[model samples]
Target chain A: MSQADLSIPFRRRAGRAMEDAFLQEALTIATTKFIGLRREAFDAFPEGEGLRDRAREIKEATLQHLDRYLEQLIGNVERFGGRVHFATTAAEARAVILEIGRRAGARMAVKSKSMATEEIHLNEALEEAGIVPVETDLGEYIIQLAHERPSHIIAPAIHKTKGQIADLFGKELKRTVPADPEALTQLARGELREKFLQADLGITGANFAVADTGTVVLVTNEGNGRMVTSLPRVHVAVMGVEKVVPSMSDLMVFLAILAKSATGQKLSVYTTLVQGPRRAGELEGPEEFHLVLLDNGRVDQLAGPLREALYCLRCGACLNVCPVYRQIGGHAYGHTYPGPIGILLTAMLNGPASVKELAHASSLCGACADACPVRIDIPRMLIELRRQVDEKRIAPWIERVVFESFGWLLARPLLYGLAGRIARVLQRPFVRDGAIRSLPLFGDWTRTRDLPAVASRTFRERWNELERETPR
Target chain B: MTTRAEFMARIRAELGKTRGLPPATPARRPARPRVEAEAIRAELAERWPEALERFRHELEKVGGVFYRVATLAEVVPVVAGIARERAARRLVSWHAAELGGDLGPALTAQGLEPVAMPPGEVASAAERQRLRELVAAAELGLTGVDLAIAETGTLVLSSGAGRPRSTSLLPPYHIALFDRTALVESLAQAGVFLELWHADGAPGPRGAVISFITGPSRTADIELTLTRGVHGPKEVHAIFVEAPIRG
Candidate 1:
């Protein structure tokens, strides 16, 4: 789905999510459970706080010298007999992978869970080129079969129920299946196993690439990351330039906190580090290895407002703790990425104009920052994005005019007092009890919430009366 | 397409526009990683018993089975028992050179068909294909562990001659053998070994890949319901040997 097709607007998408009874229950249960699990995991690990700081520092240090690290990484990859490609945009990334697929004579490609691939719409491009792209991750596979996109970063199919998943499997596999996760998983295992062995190309996203050693790391629970990199004849790892870390020691700091933040596990089931193509003495591995380093607006963020977001691990912890995200699920954001970090990422990729409505999705709650393993000051960046939206004139005219004029009036005390008096008279007609239930020109804001009525007598007026009555 | 030169130039341009954000540096790596790693090994040589107990405890917490035996010969009975209980017939394993001993004959006597991978690369593509199919069909996969982390119950395996990555990945059940030499207390210590492995060119050719296996392959994607063995082993069994296999 293209951004243009989301013509329904953010309000309608969020409203539809709010009205979904199943989604409401699912979000509450899933996010609540994740919050508990993460708290418990951290409570047990004594060094978690220090590790988070170190991880954040590693990200900052790497970005500071990214040029040097990436060059070293490229040289080492070439030394290990692997090829590297540079992509400045999503379209260029897709083109590079498609060209690799064509040259390898690949008819089928199997993919593990990859948000980068999703961002670039690589599956659609592969299909258009007559090569079948199969999603091997269970969550990704379910969404792919259902012709949908991921609704969560880690738990992609949290919006679906067991019965809904069974139906999806039944329709795709052409058989009746039970509504049991165990049974459904076994069935998928059998089906995807065939694709794993038969597919000529395997694609994955790097969790972290060790710059000094030229290793592409993939952290997964289902081991599809291993299968994709091992079984296919050609392996392609798509990664943002920011995924690179300085050294092996720095990689370990992230390993300590990544899975704990994501799923409360001490570590994920698999963290596979692939250096290059198959070695001379190895029995089974991809003969050809390609690393596609994608810029995709991430480079621009070095000095841009969203520079801090480059430290995101995509752990999905912030989403579970976010009040707005908890109310409205990922799809309501209408982008490849979702949740607090997703809003920043969307602006980084599609520009600030794309996130005009999304910028205000947060209540400036600091819960996301506390929940983040890397401690990204998400609320700070979100406020900056909102300012950018209004400054760029991407926000609605009414919102801009109201906030801008409010700022203008606040700078002058006389005008502010006069405006307060004017609001008191104007609000009398719409005030019900203590709050304004509705208003003219901006009724949309008060439709779902009540705005407090301006006090009958302004504070200045009360103070002036006090001065006349008291000599002190 | 963006050239490497062009991409770096763009990054440098953006970086030049920034000023004093904060003073930060990456985690400090050991100056002589090889020496540091050796020191860790020397310390572990005395504390392996405690580390092994922690490893077993953590492994069991993640739904894995852990066993400690007196010798390499004792591992066969455990493997046979696991196979017997599961009614498994075919087993794929690393070659004797990588595993430290050949258990093919003993495993066959236990009524299991065993196929150990070639010590070096297969001569023919057809042979490689046949081995892959065999691994995919096998019910059990056995290999050796390079490092067993006590804090997280992770088994680190490097892919190289004789030891294919699939021996720990392909089948429904995976069994790994480790000893005191491979035991580590934390992921930080594992990092030291990792740095040492890639340090000064003094050793043989390193493998192209290293995997850290924490538990069986799992997923909770379907409505947050956890299920195991989605694409990798459903069960992971770690057998700790009291007597070193190499010795």
Candidate 2:
């Protein structure tokens, strides 16, 4: 419940979010608006199918040949008067950026929105090192001020209402702040603008990293990408290895989908492509540029059926349209990345050893894959991960025992019949109005939906009577 | 990390490990010789004129102006009138025949000084402070759109000659010009425009992105309340040069 123990499974922590009515309403409103906007943004367009297809092809091909592209990208970025760092894990990434922060003498950092930072807990790292990491995006800035982590990907503060934000800011600043979206935005803007002016380093994330041109593309509705990339003396972009594309041409395919997929705009209000820090003649760019490319578990995913999962553009379109995600919301997923995409991402990044239960959270309905812009087979990946966990003996003994009993019943007809008869007898205690009202060992399910009662006559007994009634 | 070759070899080994990718079913290919771009352009042009008008109306709703001009000859005289009307001093426009040496001489002769904007100066705070110096000292900013969208009635600009991203962002007043063909049905069509710009057929990766300006630089950033031209151009002028595309 405290910051000291934040690594608990989503199931345990999600209850707190589920209990907050304001968070529920805020999430519902924000997601509904986003889903509608995305639908209206790309619905029945000629370019929709072509854009998605091209994006998918580009991602799959990049994952297949990722190392070659990454090397070329790194070389070209270095050639363009920029530095490239390869970090294989979150710790490595944080350490690399922290070192950059130290080298740049960054007392303060102004950043655009980055999910990777949330995954790595970069703010905590910066704060520990006596560096202030200021989030420039309005939503992120509000949440940072409140000392909370992002509940959603694109819009991190999607779960909090204006009233909650006002209350938090009021308490923190020792002054009353109005609970209006307009007023709250203005107050945060006034507060963060000073940080941007004083920042020594600007941190950002890449929407697409073009290898051929050694360009990092950032698409944002707010001008934060530009401010973060250009204003500060040193600019550091932390990107996952999967964010790379082969060429500028390949970058075009993603640029087509990311805007409409994320916010349903023709393009983000601002899309800045940083070729290599500051060129000699360029007047308004960082003096030095550092790109930290993190691998972590992406290389492992690239060689398998799960490679398609790497094709994600972080459009959040999949999350927007998912039925289960819509019902349970992003906070319920409990991982830094939540929803169907989160399920695969958390398992992959957390490794199978740490998360044996997160894999089972999926409904296996294939909705996530259906809604995926790059078409990651999420349900398939979930199933594969479950298999890997079983094979590696990472699954809990109770799960193994339950499934063993399932196999036991299937292999023995007499035992299966006897079990059915006993279940019917046992149903009497719990049955209320022909539905099982209360059952042990199954509260999470029965609490929400009614459990159907077992039929009175066994199929075998009915079959035997029918055989007797017939001319046998 | 690992050697790039070892990384690639792992892929080859994986390919060998699995059955070869499922055989792709053969399908008939479209029997088209080439894209008839001229025909498409002409059809687009016809629909785009009305689309431009509709777009102009939309931009107007968001506090923008739509001007219809016939000739480059009229453009200089009109800009001079705007300067005289606003008591302007300095003006910034894109590097085109529409606002070039030919027109520069005419504007000077008409008692108006023309200034070309430096590229990519918008991102610099120091440059911004300097531009604020220039913008406060000056009266008007003029630039050409990189492209325009018909569906949204938006203008797309990038970092290029005459159209400095900073000039558009720093100046209080901006005037942008485009042809009717700049109009697309919607943002989806605009994506195709961008993809085509990066396509092998078109020039590749023109710096940054296609910045679509539906109206003036407006933001709901200040307390989620609508404020115009806080960081960019306060007022915008969208001119539809309703004439045939000169080759």
DockQ top scorer: 1
Supply DockQ values for each candidate. Answer: 0.79, 0.20
List fnat, each candidate: 0.90, 0.09
Enumerate residue pairs that collide in model 2. Answer: A182-B223, A185-B223, A186-B223, B94-B162, B148-B182, B150-B183, B150-B184
What TM-score do all the candidates reach, one by one?
0.97, 0.81
Give the range where candidate 2 chain A is weakest over 10 consecutive residues by summed lDDT.
A1-10
Candidate 1 residue-wise lDDT at A203: 99
Error of 1 at B81 (Å): 0.9
* Model 2: residues with Cα > 4 Å off, grouped in runs: A1-9, A168-175, A322-324, A458-472, B1-67, B70-129, B132-142, B151-154, B160-163, B170-175, B180-237, B243-247
Clashing pairs in 1: none
Candidate maximizing TM-score: 1
lDDT scores in order = 0.92, 0.67
Instruction: Write model 1 residue lDDT over B30-75, tens digit each, in one string.
Output: 8999789889989998998899999999999888999999999888
